[model samples]
Target: MSTALTFTTSRRPDGAVVLTATGEVDMSNAGAFATALAGARQTAADTPFVVDLTAVEYLDSAGLSVLFPHVEHLHLIANPLLAPVLTIAGLDDVTTISE
Candidate 1:
């Protein structure tokens, strides 16, 4: 069974695409996360992709895996709870992470 997850996509005033995720992200729902990211990419191609995970309660490796390909073009906004995990995964090396 998939965990409950919510994804909302919008364009920023500066034309950046923002994908905001709330709830748990794990193996069961990683595919949904990927789909949401893909939609954001399609909507804002060539623009910055910002992922707001401030409302996320949990994120596992499966969730992180889907973000790898877009790391260079991604900007992440997360709460203190997930900041260390992102850093540990080396996502911080490729993307801009704000806590």
Candidate 2:
């Protein structure tokens, strides 16, 4: 079987969701990214979720596209390379990136 793209999501006792995404999030892994993002959004409705991208090696616009308008808060795990993507997508307003 193909090694599925993976990410870890944890929900705090207070209901905050933290999703740490790793690996490549491209066409091959887009589905997993979408699924994980969707799940995080669903779980974060009450408290908000953070999408940590510190460990992510790559990300496609498709993955970012799916995340738009779906989640309440998206905290990016900061990377100089990827931070610009969010700015280009005009998501800088929607995300909190830690550099």
Candidate 3:
């Protein structure tokens, strides 16, 4: 099922930005994700980033592509369904995601 892309931000003492993404990340909301991630990057230039995708139930290549451009230390919290896709796509090693 398609899901909403809700965004919330938290700041670390060192200045890294943590944007929590809760819900499915599919074609529909991919742009929203990109926008949100972009906003975080603009605000926290040079700071590390962590996208908690544990609550995300689905993901597509477009969604993955949006993340490739920016952000370092990409952390996928716990997304079993999306993990395999990332792995097969060779993003599993490049992008860090936990199952």
Candidate No. with top lDDT: 1
What are the per-residue Cα lDDT tens digits for candidate 1 across 22-42? 999999999999999888877
Error of 2 at 26 (Å): 1.0
Model 2 lDDT, full chain set: 0.73
Model 2 shows how many backbone clashes? 0
Give candidate 3's total backbone clashes.
0
RMSD of 2: 2.5
- Model 2 bad stretches (over 4 Å): 1-4, 12-15
Candidate 1, 52: how far from true, in Å? Answer: 0.3
Per-candidate Cα lDDT values, in order, are: 0.92, 0.73, 0.75
Candidate 3 collision pairs: none
lDDT of 3 by residue, 1-99 (tens): 345879898877876777888877888888899998888777667666777777777778878888887636455555676678777867666767677
Estimate the TM-score for candidate 3: 0.78
> lDDT: which is higher, 2 or 3?
3
Cα error, candidate 3, residue 91 (Å): 1.9
